[model samples]
Target: MEGTKPKAGCPRAAGRVGESGMEGALVWLIYQRAPGVGRRRMAQLMRTYPDPEVAWRLGKAELAAVRGFRPDIVEALLAVRKSAEARRDAERELERARRAGLRVLCYGTRGYPERLAEIPVPPPVLYQYGPWEPDGRPVVAIVGTRRPTAYGLAVAEQLGRELAQLGAVVVSGMARGIDTEAHRGALEAGGTSVAVLGGGADVCYPQESAALYRQMRETGAILSEQPPGTAPRPENFPERNRIITGLSHGVILVEAGERSGTLITAAHAIEQDRDLFVVPGPVTSPLSRGLYKYVRDGAGLAVSAAQVLEDLGFLPSAEGPLHFTPRGLTELEQRVLGWMGSAPWWPGDLAESSGLPLPEVQACLTMLEIRSAVRRLPDGQYIRIG
Candidate 1:
């Protein structure tokens, strides 16, 4: 929301695999292949030499003269530049990416995510496997343990659906349990979602999510900083968490134990100065302990996706969902609320009037009551409140 939208009629440079774009991507791959040149070092190199072609042409002495380029790093870069094998490898990687139909986004490119660029040491190259581009929309990340409880799964899915319905992009690691549910909910609502993988954009981890991965590729996106053949190693996940939080305007933690790795994403959210929202779970569950600490430390308590949207300033005001009406409410809930006014109505009567099932009408009333958009009278009748 802080950045301006691209001017109308201006063409986007992202996803354009033109000759110049491919050449820039090749330079990034060459740097990535060098030993001891990690993300931070690569970022520093890009800062010193904004043009990869220029950096590629620099002699060893000139490379060594650059600030922060330690002797070993300079030697590594020089060796990588001269190695025919490294060049071949970089070329082979590009070929593989091309065959897979992946879009390679180089750092400082027009196609790169603006929010991600604001983070420290953003990925030098992002491999994207879908069509969803960042257009300054509200992107919120939902993350939690892979082995979540029933309650955690339900909450994650509900939040995902609600947020998607509000026209926000949902992001997650696409791991098991909560992450999978989040993606599923977003897709089910016919809304955009993105999965930041710990491995290659072409690879689907856990194997169980193969179907979900396909759905995302068609509807949302699969993103990764890793190359085409990279596997989802354990160490890569901690690093991958940074990108998850970096790409989002805020993060929602549904459930995590005391030492859950999900906390890594939450830490990155705080470090990156993004809003953090904690969903309160059962006090007896170990999964709720880590989140409670964040809440105690003043993280926003997320009872619903509408609350998150309002807190992040995505909503017009903080008066509650009903004030905005149809924006946050489900179709059924909207219809049910529309039928109610100052006069109290029973669930059966409302269902008959709206031509919906009694059970569904009852469920809608329950949700509306929870949202404080409607009030239940002593005689088991409901009336619209806000």
Candidate 2:
């Protein structure tokens, strides 16, 4: 009894601590629902008022003067604060997250991802499960199509393994296909990987990936901008992709069709000015075409793990000589080679016509042309040689 201090009752001590954290949390809630107050606009308001809690209480006239400010945003901000039902719902969500051993970090908190703060459209709040270590090595985002071929899986696995070996942490959307392969490959290689979710961090989409989601939470983290219990909506994905790229040092596209969402992530990477890498596939293969366009447009070509490392400036130079190797080729390469006609073929035309990985098809054609198995005309057309 002499060494022990008397226990304080719940109401006074707990209330003071809660009150200190509550204002910031409330401001974050207001920011999340503020319709037109995006990252830049919110920064503007925060700058003008110097306090988000005070800014949230600003009258319509005060908010209207801010750049890109809108009437609806002010209305939404005020309405959420005034609505008892909305407040109740938010409280329920918070309680549910607490029950699940999760934690929420608003944009202005010490726990918020620092890298995300640099983005133009940073999420005002981030909901996370498990530990988040931004300083933990380099985080590389690996993304691709929802329906990946076995070849894409192979490439993703190889790259992930190499990335892990290099002490890089992999990040992805936790989607099906190539995204799944990337995370799985990283974990299989005994590396860490983060999954940025389109829904609440607690809710796993493609519900079949629940096990993977659990694995990611234990070994890495599951992150989201939405509060817990938020359903998966179409709009959440595009918004979520930014965080995936924002949290990484670079992004690697494994395989993506012309209109793949992975391309959205690549666009975000470019906008964020993070390094971008693409694996080129056959023109005929829907998955590789989108990636080829990125590669041809001066994006780093993911020929091998060392190229990725070199392009990222992690390695001083590429490991070996600049030469082609046949061991990298798959069965699709042999088939595509044997079937080409004597007529000339465009890289796009040939790949689309041959049904191979665009990069693989392109690599083979380049090799064949060099070996006289084919010839490249002055017009950029390819022709079989005698």
Candidate 3:
């Protein structure tokens, strides 16, 4: 984040894009709802029509002439614009959002999150419900599987707590498992946590999280690109993940299965060039498999919050070195544990590396897994958890 200055016109150069400018932005929010329409097509529209307001007035035949415009989607767009209903609907929703204490961050205007502007399809208008700071404080995303093991949950909460206490804003999807725990931890530390929703910023999908939602609304911030009344659809999550990555200084994967939805966020982090860290967990647990793979593939291995803080140039100072206890570990298990680094390793490779028989190496790994000292990966790799 060093030397990363906020862009011009992002509240530093001017004021928020007024209601009139919002109309220009509203074209995107409404058009994207049409099937197969997205940021790319919207970009095309802006180029083809030059003025968003003029594009909004285009008839079906005019729209069809644009390159890459689909026949089916053109009709959908025409339907929404039929009698100017879509424009009115967007206007009314924008008014409702303002009445509900939400702020609209119009694209190409003042007050949008600066980091998001660097992404490919930054939301045209973000429905936000709290304060925004573009003063260069690091924003770290803590995400994991929705159904995590006890260890994964614990690590996520701890990471969130420590990061917030050390002066970083925690960014997350506000999903059921790890995201919820991370947000709670940030709140526990009296620090801000930004919740990016897959649905409307006004809608809290898991009704059980209502209390937490209230806390965030009062203290942190809740944002969404979806329209005011949109429901939580399955397809909404991947795009939501992109926003999470788009808004962070880095990302932490506490745990993930091979097929967990959290992988979507991880992929976005890579594509966005956000630094990634993975917390190792028990190999026998499916929740930890993807994390081990990430570490093996060159993601940073996170053993403590200080490691991340130091990498971010937060000047973290550790009090003491981490110590290991082998009181209950068999001699072979202890030796195998010693051989394993923070990086993940396979038993076959470990056997060769440690000069032990393959069967003996496998046995030691199972012992370590049972003791919660090593985690098993989906592809039979292992990593030290402590």
Candidate 4:
């Protein structure tokens, strides 16, 4: 036995196959394949098992002892083990990433983002390439509609440029419209900007953003949680949007409609307890409606980069344009606030423009009204009080 090669059935033979880091990747592969197993559940399981190879050694009953493990999950786990195709597929992806100059950061790696680790359920394994230093400075996420109006584009560009000029890293999804404008504005200003991709970091989504993506890779960085070579799927975008928010100190909603996916990103920001800012948009435009609702609901109104910088404590209280005491409300608060340069809006029109249900729209409006921040018009509309 001492001179003989170990049998294939031996535990040591299995151990000889994959080493520690590679084993972790394989665990992630199996975890990814397990139906209904998401990042959070995988995290929970990993916390308990800590060793992927060991976890794989467990029988159905043993695995069932883990929380969140169900019969279907057990079956999925077993299936993943038996699926030679999954192993081959993962190996191919791994090799592809190696050839493409991409690196992966599985959850328990040295290169993982520290801020992301603080979240309740961080991604199990994050795929990324290019520069990823936090640089010990606050990050701000600027996002908006994929199809922004000219006004929206202008605000995104101006804000991004100014924010970068001031030393804050501008972050966005690199989608078209506002996101693209934000990244471009920052880069044009010679500032660092990060593009969080919905697909693999190596795979550019909007196709038109290829140039911008290249610029970011050169000047800043493009990051994603998906594996390298993974194509953009409809579901992956929203999930990646969460990471975009998670990595930021605050999120600026530029020109989102009520149902815009950008709002979902904003929701993730709120969930992360990050500061929320919204640019005022014309009530006449559906694009600005979501922004109006946010402004009414006590989100910081970003009229200028100075205001945002001041609110985030990035600047001394004394550094911005003179802070004026807000004037009390009156009947014409509607007409005047309504006409205030197409930046802000009233609630009724915001709802109509944003296409959000009346209840959600009213909820935002009511909150704004109670704060004396917005006045209700006699016409049953709401406008910013200040």
RMSD of each candidate relative to the true structure = 14.3, 17.9, 15.8, 16.0
Two-way TM-score contest, 1 vs 4, winner: 1
Q: Where in model 2 is the C-alpha error above 4 Å?
A: 1-23, 34-51, 57-62, 71-83, 315-386
Please list the residue runs of candidate 4 whose C-alpha ends up more than 4 Å from where it truly belongs after superposition: 1-23, 46-65, 78-83, 315-386
Per-residue CA lDDT of candidate 4, range 193-275, in tens?
99988788889888998888888888788888777878888898888888888777778999887789998888788777778
> Per-residue lDDT for 1-386 in model 3, tens only?
11235333121111223532454456665675566777777656655774555666788899999888989879887776543555566667777676666777766555667678767667777888767554345688999988887887888899888877877789998999999999989889988898999999999878888888888888788989887767899999998999999988778998888988889898989888778888878888787876777788778877776677666433311212222323466777767776774568988998998899999999888887887667898988997653
How many clashing pairs per prediction, in order? 0, 10, 3, 2
lDDT of 4: 0.70
Candidate 1 wrongly placed segments (more than 4 Å): 1-20, 58-67, 316-386
Which number leads on TM-score?
Answer: 1
Compared with the true structure, what per-residue lDDT tens digits does model 1 show for residues 301-361?
A: 8899878977875532222232223347886776666566445799999888779999998
lDDT (tens digit, per residue) of candidate 2 on 193-307: 8999998888888789888888888888998877787889988898799999999877999888778888899999989988899887777987877788777778887877667
Q: Compared to the true structure, candidate 4 yields what TM-score? A: 0.70
lDDT to native, each model: 0.80, 0.70, 0.75, 0.70
List the pairs of residues colliding in candidate 4.
280-343, 346-382
Relative to the unseen true structure, what is the C-alpha lDDT of residue 290 in candidate 3, on a scale of 0 to 100?
69
Measured against the true structure, the TM-scores of the candidates, in listed sequence, are 0.74, 0.70, 0.68, 0.70
- Alpha-carbon deviation at 172 in model 1, angstroms: 0.4
Considering only N, C-alpha and C atoms within 3 Å, which residue pairs clash in candidate 2?
280-359, 281-357, 281-358, 281-359, 282-357, 282-358, 283-351, 283-352, 284-351, 284-352
